[model samples]
Target: MEFDELQDLARGVRQKYAAREHENYGRTWSREEIMLGFLGDVGDLAKLVQGKEGVRPREDLDEAFAHELADCLWSVMTLADSYGVDLEEAFVSTMTELNGVLDET
Candidate 1:
């Protein structure tokens, strides 16, 4: 799927999670909470990467890695939405800047 399509899907899932969070905890997660969750997901992805690289012992590394990546993506999209940031543009701009830096070396 394209970037926009993926972002839309992420938003839909985030909305459902918001509803679930409200029903269970009386409120949806705050941005800081979302960032914390993203950190946790990043930790999980790190372990999965280690496993994939034969440095850690984890079962189902491939599937878990994919899920963790999706989880991270969801958190990023949700955070960007919360802050009214244009994530796609930011990503492209950041990448372009990084590439320029690399080319100057």
Candidate 2:
């Protein structure tokens, strides 16, 4: 699916979590809280990457690696949505700039 579609799906997932938070914690997570969660996911993803590279041992291996990466992506999409960022546009623009810099080298 497109990035926008994926972001919409992430929003739906966030809504479900929000409802649960309201029931369990009496409040949904703030944007900063969500960003912290994203940071946790990033840490998990880094470990998975290390395992995949043979720098660390991991029994779960393949499935955990892919899952953690997806989790990180979901967090990124949700965070971008929260900030009103057009991630697709931002990604393309950033990559274009990077490519330009690489070509200049």
Candidate 3:
């Protein structure tokens, strides 16, 4: 999907969970939880690397990578929701600058 489509999709997903947050009237995930999720996904990526060296099929490796990435993205999305950050805007702005730097290099 396009960037706008993806952003809309994320908004819908967040809305679903945000409603639950409202139902319970409890806080969303904390910063620590988001950070832990990030670190855990990184560890999972490393494990996939090790597993890749084993006799596992390529499909297994791809599946593992996809799931870990999705988990990491969930944490990021949840974090953005809690903090009121616009994830798509941040991504575009940061990547624009990063791309400039890469071009300079």
Instruction: Report RMSD (Å) for each prediction in the order shown.
Output: 1.2, 1.2, 3.8
* Candidate 1: residue 16 Cα off by (Å): 0.3
Candidate 2 Cα lDDT to native: 0.91
Query: Candidate 2 lDDT, tens digit per residue, 10-83?
Result: 89999999999999999999999999999999998898889899998779899998898888888888888889
Q: Name the 10 consecutive residues with the lowest summed lDDT in model 1.
A: 56-65
The sequence of per-residue lDDT tens digits that candidate 3 reaches over residues 2-105 is 75676567668767866776688677544786578679888887787777777444666878877887777776776775688888889999999999999999
Error of 2 at 18 (Å): 0.9
| Per-residue C-alpha lDDT of model 1 across residues 2-99, encoded as one tens digit per residue | 98898899899989999999999999999999999999999988988898999996777888889999898899999998999999999999999999
TM-score of each: 0.92, 0.92, 0.63
Colliding residue pairs in candidate 2: none
Which structure is stronger by TM-score: 2 or 3? 2
Model 2 TM-score, 2 decimals = 0.92
Model 3 clash pairs? none
On a 0 to 100 scale, what is the lDDT of residue 56 in model 3?
A: 42
**Candidate 2, residue 60: lDDT:** 86
CA lDDT scores, all candidates in order: 0.92, 0.91, 0.74
